[model samples]
Target: MNIKKHAVITTVIFALNAPVWAGEASFIAELASTTLPQQAPVVASISTSNTYFMTSAPFSANSSAAITHQPQPDPAITLPQLIEKDWWGALAEITVVLVIGELLYKTGEESMKEDFDYEIEGNTGRYFVDRIVTTESWKLDDNEVGMNWGHAYAGALYHQAFRNYNFNYYESMLGNFLTSGIWEVFAEYKEVVSINDQIVTTFGGSVLGESFFQLSEMLDTKEGWVPATFAGVFNPSKTLRGWFSDDTANRFDRQQSTDQFDIYTGALYSTKDTADISTTTMLLGVKASIDSVQGQYDALSATPSLVELDMELGISAEGIEDWQLSSSLFLGGYTQEVKPTTGSRESWGHNWFIGPSMGIEYSSLGQEDEEDFFAAINVIGLSAGGEWQNADFNISVRGDIFGDFSMVKPFASKDYQASGGQFWGTKSVLWEGGYAYGLGHTAKLTLKQATENCY
Candidate 1:
């Protein structure tokens, strides 16, 4: 093995070496309310509502109140899972990703400036062997575009396409694996297949993709020009295809019932040294939490128990200086509800939650070149929290600590002055770029309080 020795360790870094300033932690205070779903709570599920605050960017000060429902069990109520499929949409989208994507990519100047002669020597079978199981192996790609949100976004599109075709979550994921393999082997035949891309594209895409898919479904239930525009933006290809479905163009037939939906907006005024901005940033956010998760526990279906998204876009004189978005999907976990006792009746009630979660965070706070490592995919993590609800007011708290993975700029790179992603990405992608794949961690602390006069 012509293995070389270098000071930089390509393995995971389990230290707090992040560039975020500790003092830059933004204060969070919001006044919010949760509107319960119209339909009764499903069996095996409890009625729940909450609003949480976090010590993150886009700080605000407001009060909140949530009308919550207590837990109840129904032994007789049992529902069967529904399964659907649309093979044509999924198959066609895959074709677009490969055939059309390749065509468009070739038009770019950077993509045309390529080298490394690759061809099918000997026979086609031997070529397949060398590419898949032999010489043409996998390597960590060093490109900034494909390594971060780009490939994951592509994967998200694939996941939504499969889901829109009525494929369950696991089925969509299975399709994702197949789609990625096909793209790596068939689409980009010139370069060696990326082993990291295989994993990141499949799993990271699924986490990010499933979150967007569920949120898109939630938005589809709304009625307004704003909701429709946001929905179409979030799921563009799916929306366009839905309109042209069978050439019918029926826009209202895709509505799906959701358990809860809450939307809030705030304006954050930043001082100096706190953030990259000095002006006020308008903030808007939406959150959804569903209890009765449809389908079976086999996890082969496309329904997540709890899906919530928090996104903030900072618009100032610089025209959107900071943009941050985070999405979380709670797959599964065990909960032991400890009802309030005589001694702990005031604050501690039969209200608590703990579970494993999958999520993705895309943050471009300052400039792309200044802080590019903020976006990290939470491969897998744990989330646990509880609430204190009374007739007059409510207070809920949640804290999350997650291990993250991302394509971080190398601590030291040979090409320090490369401008734009193309400079370090083009010509060479495996090890010649300013960034490389690595692992990190993030911790969030949330607390929300409210006072309401409700009967």
Candidate 2:
């Protein structure tokens, strides 16, 4: 059966079986209450009369207390009361992703095997069963490097579509996995299932998807056209839904919140020295953060939601250039307050995050070479950081840790090397602090090491 039919049957079975399990406790409670002694009716009548007498009295100091003492009925048990059953939105999102994948495949965006032996026909059921039960060995395909990266981006878009329909973070993640799985198993039935595509699309997509979601949320709060336009681009599912249905727009309206937004642009200079050669590169960057503004009593209590973006363009003395981008979105955090005998109060907070981070480095010395070695790393993973802030001075110190699945490629002279396999590692560190006048600076150190052999 197709995914839709499977989902419908599963939901029906659950609906039929749910009442039996949920009604057991309720039935026993009602049975015990029904079997009480015959004098219970007389006692209940007397209690009700007393309650009525108290409530019917003229206004008095004790009158309010009488209402407080009244008995309330036990709440009824129902299917919705026992479980949250909002899977239709999720199912619709999955269907949309599947349909889009089929469209892309049919439009020549993807290639199929020459024999076309896996075509859906009288053997549709057997084909699905075979795909599910069979496991293929890991191997590399001939798709371009850009196509590989596009898979992660597609995954992120799929995730955003699910979120647009009000799915939670974990549910949205499963939607991405399902979308990728559908594309791998059935959309390209003639091609071999790719292990790399699965990992990058699901995990890396999560990092990018969450960041995009936060950015879209942040943009939605602004009243200007520029922000709204970008928000729609980042979250197309919501934009499209709004065009077709008013209820979808209303639902998203309820999700928007009042949050602070700030944007800053600056320049950075870094000097590198190796042996007798020294090189300097100039970077122009823009940084934006939402809901990260500090308050007077922020040291005591602060808003924990934050979405941050930093994008930079690096130019060497010789004019060779590269682009770098890093983004992070935090769902929630834990905070603690510290008080010292002679110093101001300090607040420390730690937050968990998922997002995309990418960096590129040039190999050759600058100022003369037309071509340089290109090394780039892309990863998506769980990240965490702790910050100590003193709202009195508006200063804070932070340290971050990253554990991720990474793809590293080294290229030169208009040719790029293919990524062999997925690698796992801790990639970078950032330490930053700022003063009242924004006179402070940030310092970051990155470490890259190979942990496993690849193709």
| Best by the TM-score measure | 1
TM-score for candidate 1: 0.67
**Per-prediction TM-score:** 0.67, 0.54
Candidate 1, 295-358: lDDT as tens digits: 2121211245566777777676657667777777765444333333323225343345566667
lDDT of 1: 0.53
Specify the poorest-scoring 10-residue window by lDDT in model 2.
Answer: 429-438
For candidate 2, write residues 333-408 as lDDT tens digits: 3322222222223432221222222221112223322223221223212223333323232223444343333333
lDDT, candidate 2, residue 20? 44
lDDT of predicted model 2: 0.43
Question: What is residue 341's positional error in candidate 2, in angstroms?
Answer: 14
Model 2, position 334: C-alpha lDDT score: 31
* Clash pairs (backbone) in predicted model 2: none
